[model samples]
Target: MDRSLILGLLIFLTLLAMPFALPLIGQGYLTGLIIKAMLLAIAAISLDLLIGHGGLVSLGHAAFVALGAYAAAIALQSGIENILVLLLITLALTGFVALITGSLALRTTGVYFLMITLAFGQMAYFTLTSLAAYGGDDGLTLWSLATLFGSNVVQKGNGLYFIVLGTLLASWWFVNRMSQSRFGRVLRAARDNPERTEVMGYSVTRYRLVAYVIAAMIAGVSGLLVMQHAEFVSPALAAWQRSGDLIVVVVLGGLATRNGAILGAFFLVIVEELLGSFIHEWRLIYGPLLVFMVLFAKGGLSDLLTSKRRGNQVA
Candidate 1:
């Protein structure tokens, strides 16, 4: 019944009830918004694995999402309809690319690593744009949603919603476990003190490369969901601006906390929606809000919420 577990439980219940609750509130259009947030949260959480735990700041993380989406579109284009098969292909493709890029990127640290990731990302974006057969610069559209076990379950009512919710929960749990494992310890130690960790016999480069691959695979899964949800795969998914937003989501949520990504995703998407609705020039306000958060809320909203709970408990 501690704060962390309580927070986790609250998130779980809220998501579980969203589909039903949103409809009753006559704001069911928000369901799509929630799904978008959840999917983005998955990507953001994966990025957090690198940023928070591995201390790697990748500016091109969105490339993996675009890769996943393209993988799905390409697979379907090639006559593949099985959701499982598409996901496997997508994850494998993402893993392969991540391994190759990570091997090279991990050779450098700090700003060099960040820049290399960005380069790889842009390479992916341009490559997608050049794919004329699949819509290229205009992007490709799925004829329909991928079938699960030969059924249109994903295209049916609330089926995709529930599936996405399940995936998000599983991802949150998996990342949480990963952050608490011995491997997690090695990653954190390497992050805090690479030389000492290297002297202790752990291969820092290999650890980071593995983390990068895992994060990429997770982002790929989110891409799968995105393609299903949007029925469109565009090079825009791999744009540097998207990657920057993912980073913003991670930092905005409170780096290092298991639920921070989720909280940040909800906050970012909701705020954007509010601003877009109320102001013609939303970025003017949104940009400053991010700067304020970075300057004043070092731990992000997750930390802000937990602090209040701690104060209440102490009293």
Candidate 2:
């Protein structure tokens, strides 16, 4: 078997067995932590599509997460308890917002694009904070969460965990496929040389805008899942800090690598949990790790798992 396939199978098996195996070792509580990591992975994967393939640095990505959460929460508050409906609403809103914001943000490149994204993210945060009816700055605690055919399976137990895992896998696969597609090639062309791509008859901004909307929709799905898991929605979900973390995850994993975001997200969560368990100054340690990775690990942490063990091994 190919080494990559072997590694993938190993990862999939481990994740599938985690819920059952952890309980036998009295580490069942880690399930929630793993779920958190997976959710973050989902969001990070979406951001990766922007930063890696599209060469778009969006500081406002987490705003879609917040929007998705708030949209679901508010819908539940207004008596919409169906998960499907909530997901659709979340996608539509996030996609529409991304279209508008991306169209405007794509007007610039490099630092300007980054700054505009930050501005849009802050605008989303303030907007969420001002929603007095939905708990304002305090956030809204969900009394009722979305359900699949009125079943509570998705609300707790092993169901939500598996669903999230599936979503993570789907996101990884989707992004990988998209990255190899012709559209992704055009995006890459634009990213490498916009003027050249434009001269070749491609609309750089349009391609970027599409990528932005797709990323937002995926992030929104992550947001909805987050709200479901937390049973709460807050403006904090869309905070600029959260957006920064997503970027860190993408970079920490590996840019333009298929599994980079997943690897990065899991590594980050584990490190934080491990360090925070021992030291109160966990974030202080976080900075050094990034520096170390940047200094020593050229392809980011993903390469650690992905690269062949032997130098002569052909992948």
- Candidate 1 accuracy as TM-score: 0.96
Q: Write the per-residue lDDT of candidate 2 for residues 1-315, one digit (tens) a residue.
A: 766556656777899999999999999999999999999999999998888888888888899999988888888889888888988999999999999988888998988898999999999999999999989999999878789888878888699999899888898888878988999899888888889999999988999999999999999999999999999999999999999899889988877776778788889899999999999999898899888877887667666877754221101
Using TM-score as the measure, the top candidate is 1
Candidate 2 residue 310 Cα shift, in angstroms, is 16
Which residue pairs overlap in candidate 2's backbone?
A: none
Quantify all predictions' global Cα lDDT against the true fold. 0.90, 0.87
Model 2 CA lDDT for position 96: 93
lDDT, candidate 1, 1-315, per-residue tens: 567768978998998898899889898888899899999999999999999889999999999999999998899889899999998999999999999999999999988899999999999999999999999899998786799888998864589999899889988998989988998899988988899999999999999999999999999999999999999999999999999999999988877786889999999999999999999899999999988987887777788888642210000
The CA lDDT at 295 in model 2 is 85
- Which candidate achieves the best lDDT against the true structure? 1
Model 1 Cα RMSD, 1 decimal: 3.6
